[model samples]
Target chain A: MKTNFRTAVLTVLIGAGTVCSAVAQDATTILQKMDEVMYSQKDMTGKNKIILIDKAGKQEIREATIQQKGTDKRMFRFTAPASQAGIAFLSLPGDVMYMYLPAFGRERRIASSAKNQNFAGTDFSYEDMESVPFSQKYTPKLIKTETDAFVLELTPKVRSDFSKVTVSIHKEHFYPILMEYYDRGGNKVKEAKYTFKKIGNYWNPAEIEMTDLKKGHTTKMQMTDVKYDTGLSDDAFTVRALVQ
Target chain B: MKAKITVLLFSIFVAISGKISAQEENNIKLSGELLTDQRLLLRDNNDWAWNENRLTLKLDKQISSESKFYSEIWLRNIGLPNAVHSSSLYNKGIIDPYNLEIREAYLQINGFLNKKIDLTLGRQQIVWGTADKLNPTDNLNPYDLEDILDFGRKRGSDAINLQYYFNYDFSVQGVFIPFFQPANMPVGIFADLLNPSIAMPQGMVLNNFSDTLMMPKYNLGESSTVGLRFKGFAKGVDFSLSYVWGYDGLPYSSKNMLTPVNMNGETNIQSELSFMRNHIIGVDLATSIGGAGVWAEAAAFIPDQDMVMTTDLSALYPGSPEPVTQDSVLLKKNKPYIKFVIGGDYFFADGSYLNLQYLHGFVHERGSEGLNDYFFLRYEKTFFNEKLKITPIGGGFIVTDWGDINENYAIAYLPEISYKATPNAEITLSAAIFDGKGDHLFASLKDYNMLMLKMKYSF
Candidate 1:
């Protein structure tokens, strides 16, 4: 009777380990698929707008011509709201960034120390707009499987503003549906939600909303006229390009 | 010839506009700004206040895929004729203080030399420095000192700038300015002291008010003004090395000596202000570390000759005018000096930013302590979703070897609060306070303590 009991216990333990391994693999696969789908293009250009809503429901809008090259470079030139016109921002790899303000008539290099700070008075931080691939920056573990979404708890593999992030991914298209950012104390501080739509052979987030729980403010970035694989020049994503 | 030149330029503009209108992708943008300032002098309850209104109109035209044109004109000082001298229209039939000043009109072309070179021609502002306000490498344009109450404003330069890009991260640029523009200095009244426009005895109440200031014009060439810049980004750091063979923008002269003349029933002082060739070599670096932005800039100036100014103070202190109580003295010369600044800035979570800097100016020539050190601090806070920004900026200067009779230190503080009422409108309120004694920087401008309000509307 003792020998039979030991055999049963071992079989159950082995089966549980195998199940845990398979679950982890599934979480990674989901994250990889999401990254692959959004990062499939070499370059893209889009007309973007950021709408900032304050606590009192006052709204301010900024419009820009946003372009991206390769997977690591991004540039934006503000065109609306005369006060912010002719302002350009360029982001390169290694957290290198630059800003050209027409009022100053020169390009200023931006350091990486303020990555977690607000970007252009928006609720989104610079890190929130950073293009570091999710699969490259975080390690995911399957927390639960929903009826239509996969919940993955991510621990940053690199230095990040958030201690932990819980993300929800669409089951069919593998696009990120939601992300809740937690502080070091494990308190939810911010949440980002995305609504994806298929556009010209690719899935894109047509609407993105970022909410700051502490500040009680929300910022929405809506994408329009987005074209993928447009063959943007590498020079266009550089600091020198800000002059134009 | 002038009319012909104007017609030729007009033809070029019309041709470009025609081409752009024909293209489907061309865009023409029109925008402008009007800034109105109302200031009150704390010391002067009656006269000598800061009041000015400015209007700027800008045009941006995309001529083609590789060409663009931009232009701006400034209409300054709307309410009074005191500031009408800057307007050429005043010389014409327009008799109001509503003066017109062309700020920038530049055409930029790309895709030259197989897409490696670019050019910008006409009047434009070019800023070159890594530091904030305490920049040592920004010597491109002459300053607008006509309004002493307002500082840090500069006029654009007419030039042709050529740039050659290398690998998109580095570039070599050369600027050729065909002419020279000197800093503007206006005559002002001194209630209880000597007027700065003329080198007369302090506190001397002369029966006749007469002074002659002769200003010389300098032509541009290898001996006058030229700029060369090389900038590159490497290893997460951006750096630039530049040189300018230029003249002092603030019309200084080797013949600044004052001569109290008594000739042909005239008793006044004559001072000559001229420009000479000078060379400046500058280098700057900027990088990020941990979460703070660090930058430094340094420039070394070499002048063709030394400047000397004579001060005769004994005649004004209850002394005889002929056998002066003390002999006239010539101030020392600062032949060549170096100016440098290092600064860093950081942002806090509450959307507050802070910057601190240290600047060392080698001003004193023959002293153990030749350096004048200044510490600059600036703090800004964005409130109510960035609609309101409050900034407090100040500095402390420590002159190591101060003047024999002047104060050894000085301090200045300015706090400004600006509110963005709308996307195209802003209001700013600020105050300037200065304190020192006897030849210190703040002491010199102690009478300029003021409260200012400015409204800016943009479209």
Candidate 2:
């Protein structure tokens, strides 16, 4: 009777392993799909309102213009909040970044070693703004599967501020709506949730909220006038563009 | 002072209400700012001597796909108080301490060569250097140095600027100014140390031997200034090479004639300051390394003529009789010098930002050697979700030699605190504390230790 029970447990264990492997493979496919749909071959332009909520529940609103190309280059120019207007940020490949301030009337090339620093006093860090292809930066493993979404934990291949990131991908559209960043101890320190809207042929995030658990503050970004497939020239991404 | 503030407040209210009513009916976009600035003296009876009511209107409209118009008109009324003793003699409304002024106006067109070239014309400010806060190579706009401490206000020059982009990494920019406007020099008690005059006995007068008298004359049509800049990214750095043919922003002279007069038991002295034209070749570079932003700006100026500070008693004014003795005179040369600044900035995750920079005036000649160097730092941190920011700043030149620079070094501390009362309004409180040897730059301003507060609003 003991031998029969052991054989039956072995068969069930093998079946479960196969199912888990299948789900893990599906997770990889889903990540690839998200990357494919999330990026554009041409350029894109949009505007966003950055609402910063402090610990006291007070809100500070800032408006900005966002432009992105492929997966490597992006620029954000502050347009509202008179004090912050004309402040700009640009991130290019090679982990390079630049910032322009109206007060300085010039551009500053941000150093790579500073990548972990906060970006423009926001909850997001400089690395968070780097739009490198996720497939290039993180290795994912399917941790769980639900009826509507799949949970994947990603470990960065390079040195990163976060040891691991947990992401939730929607099953139907393969879009990432939730990302929780974890420290070495696996404690959740920060998380971001995105709301996606289908525009023409693309599914894009219309709103994003990132909350810092330790700081007790949250930053919510709402996109407006999002346009894709713009025929933006490469010159617009080069260093010469900062002067304007 | 209370009445003046009330008048300004009433005016701003009227202006804002008018704009709101007209904004919805007009297609042209309009925005403006109103500033109530006051600088209180910590050492004197003047509660806020540097008080002013400032307004700026920014307008933009798209003419077509290829062109647009942009302009910002700034008007400020600087109220008057009993002028500082050292500066009262020169104030004679030369800079118009209380008046209206237009700051900037420009039209932009992008119609040349498939939109690869663009032009900006009209009165504009062309800031040309990459250095943070302190740009040694920027010489295009004349400075409004009415308040030498207020370095942010740049008097725009009327110019036509053209830019041609050669691919993404390179561009050539040029500007032309038709007339020369010398930098505004504020002569006050603080100026005594830097430009103190030799004591004049009764019946003594000083004059310029040159044909021009008090002010240097420039032909409106012939005294045009030109500038060229080629800026782009190379290797891993953003660099620029610039050339400017212009006059010195500060008025300095080669010679002076002193005259003495005794009329009706009164003594008076008169003096004229001369200026020289100069050409500058500047190179500026900006790059990043090791988590800091690094920048450097250097300019080499070649004066058209050697500066000679001449005091000749033999040559008197046309109306006065020449001296019989032909007293001896003093002659000195203010040779050319090079100015450069190197700086770096680092920003931390917790909103702590620090920038350090050094500036120097280097010369080859021993007696005419300009100055040694020193560095400055501005450290800032934000708190309470950027609602509040505190900054501590200190910087000034380290002086050497008595001909121009005096005292070993000057140190200053300017701590500022600011609060964002609302999305459109802000209040700032700050103080300037200076210390140094008796002759250093900071020590000369020992009398002006100040606490300043300002409130600004934007629409």
Candidate 3:
């Protein structure tokens, strides 16, 4: 009787393990699908309007032109707020980044370790501006499922400022609606909310708001004149083009 | 002639602006800034050092898919004019301390001959090197020291720059400047004190002193400058090798004369100053290691001739029974001397930055023996969502003679705070403090401690 009981318990435990494994696989698949949905375009160009709101409700606006090729190359050139005009940032594969200041008339290489620093006084960090896919940078596990969304906890595959990130993804479209970022000490530090609009065949992020929990600051980025698959050449993503 | 040139340039800009406004394509873009900078001396008797108001305008237009034009102009009122004679401003209309400057006006053509060639014509700033403000390889333009506080500023040069690209990661650039322009020295009391002093014998006192600056002739082979650079990126590092054949922007004392002593036991001295010719070979590299950005730049200057000052002292000793004697001092040997800078910068998680550099020579320092070692450091932190920044520590330490550091060392401190009043405006308050016991560069500036306030708005 004891042997039979032990066998039955073992079978039940094995069955639970299999279910957990399947759930994990499902979470990864969902994350990949979400990445594909966001980065499926061959290239994209748009004008970005960024508004910074302080704790006292003071707002400052800045504008830039953003261009991206594939999922690993992106460029941002400031066009508004005359003080910051002609400042540019280029991000390439393998965590490489370069910054150009018009006053200096030269491009400077930004270190990978500085990824956690704020980008141009905005709430978004350099890591947040990278054109990398979420599925490639993070490993996701299903935490729970709501009525219309799936909650997943993502742990970084490499060294990162955040210990983990929790994202709420749409059930039908696989697009992320909200994300909460936690610091290395496991404290929630930032929150980002996204609003996506279907542009032709692709789901484009029309607007995004990132809030710094510690600083009591929020940055709102609104995209305008968004164009996808415009056939931007690889030359546009190089350092030579960055200075221009 | 000067007024004619100014009017002509102004008319050209006005015509261009009018044409651009009439065009419907909207290809031309305009931007500008207005700034007011005031400074006060922090000495026994506090006095105003500078009260400057400036307006700058920039215009950019796309002429074609592969060509573009750009121009920048500055209109400034820097206190009262220095002219003491009414005749100096006779024909110059509305000369109320106003000056017009054409900072840059250039046309760029890409894919000139092939897909790899590009050319830029007219006046432009050709900045070189990977370091920040202190670049040893940046010599194409003359130094603009009109405002001593604005260090490392340079005047634009009229040149033709051609670049040929071997690939996306590599390129070669050549620049030819048709004329030489001398650096603008500081005005007012600083200029007076910076003049070289002559030492005389006990019995002979200085009665009169005169000096003349001899500029090179306008011939192409004598006064023109040329430069070449090869730039490339490899293994996550950007590097460049450059060469410049030019004349030094600063003049040196080349000849001197001591007049015969009069009955009052006084003598007169005359000096001639001229620019020195040099060939500079430079190399610069920029890369990142871990979390820090690192850069290094070095330039080897090879002078065409030995720098010697010949002083004819025969007249001073009229009763001497010997042949006419002359004194010769070798200021610099005809050999290669190097200037280099190595630096690194890092950003911390708390929104603070630290930059450090070790410089082997200052801008005015020349020759191996005259060069001094310096270490520059800057630390800044931002608050209030980066709207306000405080640079608590920003300065340089000069070691004039490493062997006698205790007596030959100097220190300068620049503490500053700036606030972004708006997205397009900023207000800054800063102070410059200097102290030293030796005869280093900072020692001369010790008495010029100052407090500065600057307000700038851009549109």
Candidate 4:
């Protein structure tokens, strides 16, 4: 009778251990699922450009390389018009840093106050160029589920300059599909939409559109050609490259 | 001193009132440049070396949704306002002049008359033009050196304007300028006859070469003008036409001989006699086909019914006993009084574009003198990862038989390079070879080589 009781206790302990291990595996799977979609392509080295048109039909074009590291950070190198070479812009989660020109011999850092100003004397503002980490500032609620992507309605956790920002993330890839920004007055200031395609095991967007609501202007960016793993180094981001 | 104090007190009161009432309406915008030119101005040679370092600040505050106030403050030569000219001067030499002068100050009110009209009464810039250097068709506001020297862009005028926009496609504007500063002409010895301080050799020769002789000196005359402009998309084409009339303080003069002399003989003093009203008519057209865009413009100027002529040669030799008079000689001389331009730009695949332009000046028969013909050609290309872009330009003048540069040609070779060092910064290096007067107008260190560098931040 004693031997039979010990066997039952061992069986129960084994069953509990199996259940805990299964739960841990499930959590790991979920995290990987999110990360795989977010960072499917690491070090996506390529050239891309966008042209924006205003109501007056004036056009401005911007070109850069899309780079990545780990799961959150990405750097862009501006290589067009000798005037804007070696312009380095880095984004890491909620934080962003940008450095540009100060004549030929000097490199001046951009002040935070200048972010709201116009970009290159154009209608687009500096804040309109890149995205702020949505996970840090908002309580994102999954509003709807679609076959290919998910819609998220983000409400700011604190009183801030921007009232609300809506985002769409690809379901299978976890890549960003679209983002809509709302001004302080609850007016839709601008909307950016991304369209992605699969190329050799990598999911990247071939084109993106950013439209301004108040000004009736739109900027379209297209990645015509791309080269991955080009072995670009950190030294390429220096001011010396501006002239080289 | 007492008036200045009173004015200061009033300004303070206004400031306090604005601050107390409109705390949330303050909207300030800052825009300017930190620039240095390689052309340092020279004194006498046709070739000159000129350099400029400047910064400008603009501030605006809305008194209400309907009313707003704005001002533009400038700092020039960075620290040498006094060393440079005062039109928008910065500092003199060792000390920073610390100028708080107003480049533009104005009050604007909108949503008037049931929200159908907009009224702006103050100093404001009104711009309309298509071509770069040749903007003769853009007559909304006259262009001047003060506006050009300051930024190469035209500026605002002290006036009150009203515009009624029936919709996005149609609008009519009436501008009443109580006063306007005309473009400054070079102060020549002949041009300064009225100023007695610069005395020439005693008993300098004087000649009356124009028919009209009695006219006012200052060109800043009071005038009121009303214009009807129609801008709409008709058959997918954009077009506009304008008509204006006002008192022209600087009247055109016909060369007349006070004591008749032959055309070949030596001439003396020239006087500005008589003045007249001016009537202006202008039109503009623009259309796009496929991926290319084209535009054209025409303008005509009719001087006041009674006009006079002014001569510069008179001031040079103040002691000449008898001046020569030739009307046909004066009217058809250095430059044409009327001008026009037609231009177009075409966009190509892979971020490439081509621009073509043509300009012509109409013959002015002020007793019959006309300036030579002027034209330019420009071409630009981008390649090398788009990291390198080059613009090679060449153009010159072809004056008429009697025109100054008659058949005399001058050309310019410009190569502009743009290097994108990173995603956020850019550096532009521009070099060009320009041959011309290289004087006050577009003077460089030489009538030859010019180099410019620009660093931009696109954040």
Best by lDDT: 3
lDDT of 4 by residue, B25-140 (tens): 65544443343443422235533333444455556666665556777766655323234356444433534433343556777655444354656667765443344445554444
Give TM-scores for every candidate, taking all chains together and pairing residue i with residue i.
Answer: 0.85, 0.82, 0.93, 0.51
Runs of candidate 3 exceeding 4 Å displacement? B1-25, B80-96, B261-265, B317-334
Q: What's model 2's TM-score? A: 0.82
Clashing pairs in 3: none
User: Candidate 1 regions off by >4 Å?
Assistant: A1-10, B1-26, B43-48, B78-96, B147-150, B186-224, B256-267, B306-335, B362-371, B392-406
Backbone N/Cα/C clashes per model: 1, 14, 0, 73
lDDT, candidates in the order shown: 0.75, 0.73, 0.87, 0.51
Local accuracy of candidate 2 as per-residue lDDT tens digits, B10-101:
87456434433432332466777899877877874865557677888878775554455677877876755456676776785534565666
Best by DockQ: 1
Error of 1 at A205 (Å): 0.8
Q: Where in model 4 is the C-alpha error above 4 Å?
A: A1-244, B1-24, B40-48, B62-67, B78-103, B146-152, B185-228, B246-277, B310-338, B362-372, B382-389, B394-406, B418-428, B436-448, B454-459
What's the CA error at residue B93 for candidate 1, in Å?
Answer: 10
Q: Is candidate 1 or candidate 3 better by TM-score?
A: 3
Complex DockQ per candidate: 0.75, 0.43, 0.71, 0.03
Model 2, A105-224: lDDT tens digits are 557777665676666667877787776767778888888888988888899998776899989988899888899999877889999998999988898889889999988999998999
User: Model 3, B1-459: lDDT tens per residue?
Assistant: 999999987975664444434433548889989999988889978787787899999998877666678999999887645566777677343355777999899987666645677778899999999897999999999988787657689988999999998988899999999999998887644564345557886788898888899999999999999999999988988899999999889888888888955777798888889999899999999888888889999999988778877777777667888646455644444578899999999888888989999999888888888889989999999987778999999999999988888899889999999999998899999999988868776767788899989999998
Better of 2 and 4 by TM-score: 2
lDDT, candidate 1, A1-244, per-residue tens: 9999999999999999999999989989999998987788788899989998888888889998989877789998888899998888888988888888888778887767667678887888887777767989899998989999999999999777689999999999999999999988899999999999999889988889999998899999999999998778887887767778
Regarding TM-score, does 3 or 4 come out ahead?
3
